[model samples]
Target: MKLASFRSSIESEIRLGIIVDDVIIDMESWGIEHDLDLPSTMLEFIDLGPAAVKAVSETLKNIDARSLVATSIPLSSAIITAPIPAPRKNIFGIGLNYTEHVAESARTLDTSKELPQQCVIFSKPPTTVIGPGDSIKHNDQVTKQMDWEGELAVIMGKKATHVSKENALDYVFGYTIINDISARDCRRSGQWIVSKGQDTFAPMGPYVITTDELTDPHNLQIITKVNGVEKQNGNTKFMLFNVNDIIEDISEVISLEAGDIIATGTPAGVGAGREPQEFMWPGDVVEITIDKLGTLKNYIVKA
Candidate 1:
């Protein structure tokens, strides 16, 4: 089931809801209707684990879409917040997981720094996260070379440590879209934090799709479009290191907690890899989409 965090136009508080077709069925409302007390926030649901999802599934199956109060409110009537707005740890992201992206970055930089035997990991501060349809704040003073990297982000369901690749996927709760916006100029200065941790840099979600719905995680088609032109087009099948490997590798060092996000990595095409380099500027709309999952669109705005 697709889960979302939204606030109605008349309400000031954010509430969790289950997505049914085009409408959102508020969990609290469902609980009131059925005399059940379930979680009311996305993070709360994440903490509740399978029980929360099962409850939502059961509740949705019994309720009609027309009965939801959210039906009268258009999706745009409420703002979509990050699935886990404030995660427990820094958001981890992998670099060059796709062979083509590895090759392209290698060609652009020194070829000597090529593929590695293990995953190359980096962290994006929780402060960088923004919801879908949020504006990406482009600070022209700090960075003139702002770029985008579309990646599939995996949300952990349960706490795990020293997990094996064989069972890594079992710990996943769901998946979401993340546009890993970067500042190429800041990155060239030998620091990734400034480049990656800007406010609104991490635009994630339309909704978090449960792992059970995605039968084959590695077979999905991933695409990114800037304005209206397709920029990055690739498949998870081309990933040099698959999801299970990433989970296993990461779990070996740090304990994976529920709500912690892991961005698998981006595909070949990136603005930094293009001829003359195409960087994001004010008014640029970037749309990142993955098969089975949904689209995450954000507009770039001058800070």
Candidate 2:
């Protein structure tokens, strides 16, 4: 099932809904009217476990067609927000998870730095998340080098700790697209939180697709574009540390809850890794698309 978080044309409240073909039906409203138990937010809905999945599927399958149309609103008529509007925990990210990106970084940053042998983890506060088509803001007072990292984001369905790679995918709820925007100048030294955790740096969503719909996460194509020109074109098969590896490694020490997002990291070809280096400026549009998962588009703007 494809799910989205949206609001009416005039409202600011975010509500969960199901995307039927091209149209989006307000699931919360339908559940309430039909006397079916349903959570209003995506995070809470996910916490309900397999029962919630069954409920959502049955609701969509049995709802009145005419009533659904009458009460439903066109997707273009509403505002789409990040799937997890209020992430209870910081968004987890991996750095240099692709060999090509690692090689590029070594050449651009430091030739002496050694290749990574373990998972490189980072995080961004929930405030950084913006939705598709939202404007990405950069503060000149903060950082002049604003870059983009197109990634495949995984949404967890249940609490996991010490899970093995062979069974890590079982904890996954769904997948979505995220552009991990970075403020390259913010991290003068030390860990990369400040450089990566800036507001509007995490443009996610369009929709979250359940794993049942996507059986193979490791064999998808990932493409990134700036102003309609291709910048990064890679495949998931090249990931240095696959999704299962990251999940098992992280969960072995830290507990991952339902709704927690793991941005599996970006591939090579980011602006920082290019000749003469090209960073984002105001009025620039950035888009990231993954096979089956859908496209996530956002624009760059000034503060």
Candidate 3:
């Protein structure tokens, strides 16, 4: 199921829903009508774990699409928000996980050419997150070189610590799309918090596809475009350190709880890696599409 967090209007409270045939079946409304225990927010639903998912599945099995459409709101009428509008903590980010991306970074950013033996991890504060169609703030005083990195993000379903690669995936809740917006010139002493953790720097969500629906996340195609021009096109199959490696590595040090997000890094063709160096300016629209996961689109705007 494609799960989302949205509101009927800009001033309305956020609610959780399931997207079906481009319509949003308001879970709270449905639950109230049917006397089912369903959550109103994405985080609350995720924390409810498999029981909540099972309840949704069972309900869907008994209902017809017509009933769902009749009671649901048109997706166009809903104000879609980030699947998890406010994460419990900072989002985990992997750096240089793709072979080609690493090479490109080395050439343009003067970084190491060889791939790391382990996952190179970082974090972006929750303040960076914004929903689809939200504006990516472009503060001139903060950064002049604004770039995009389209990546597949993993959402953890359960608490995991020291998990093995073989069992890492068992703890996954689902996957979603994330545009890792960055301010190239804001890096301070190799740290990314200032560069990538700025407000509205992480635009995420069309919706989250549950693990059962998106069975093979490691082989999906990822593409990014700016102003209708293709800038980055790569596949998840090329990830040097795949999802399992990342989960296991991170879990060894820090426990990953339910609803925690980990962006699995991007492929090559970032603006900073180009020969002439390209950067996004105000009014530029960026769209990132990943197989199984829907498109996450946002526009750049002056702060």
Best by lDDT: 3
| Residue 285's lDDT in candidate 1 | 94
Give per-residue lDDT, candidate 1, residue 151: 91
In order, the Cα lDDT scores of the candidates are 0.83, 0.87, 0.92
User: Model 2 off-target regions past 4 Å?
Assistant: 33-35, 111-114
Off by over 4 Å in 1: 65-76, 111-113, 188-190
TM-score of each: 0.94, 0.95, 0.97
RMSD of each: 2.0, 1.6, 1.2
**Candidate 3 segments exceeding 4 Å error:** 65-70
Over the stretch 160-234, how does candidate 3's per-residue lDDT look in tens digits? 999999998888989999999989999899888899999999999989998877877899999999999999999
Error of 2 at 62 (Å): 4.2
Name the lDDT value of residue 205 in candidate 2: 91
lDDT tens readout by residue for model 2, 274-302: 99888899989999999987889998888
lDDT of 1 at 133: 81
Model 3 TM-score?
A: 0.97
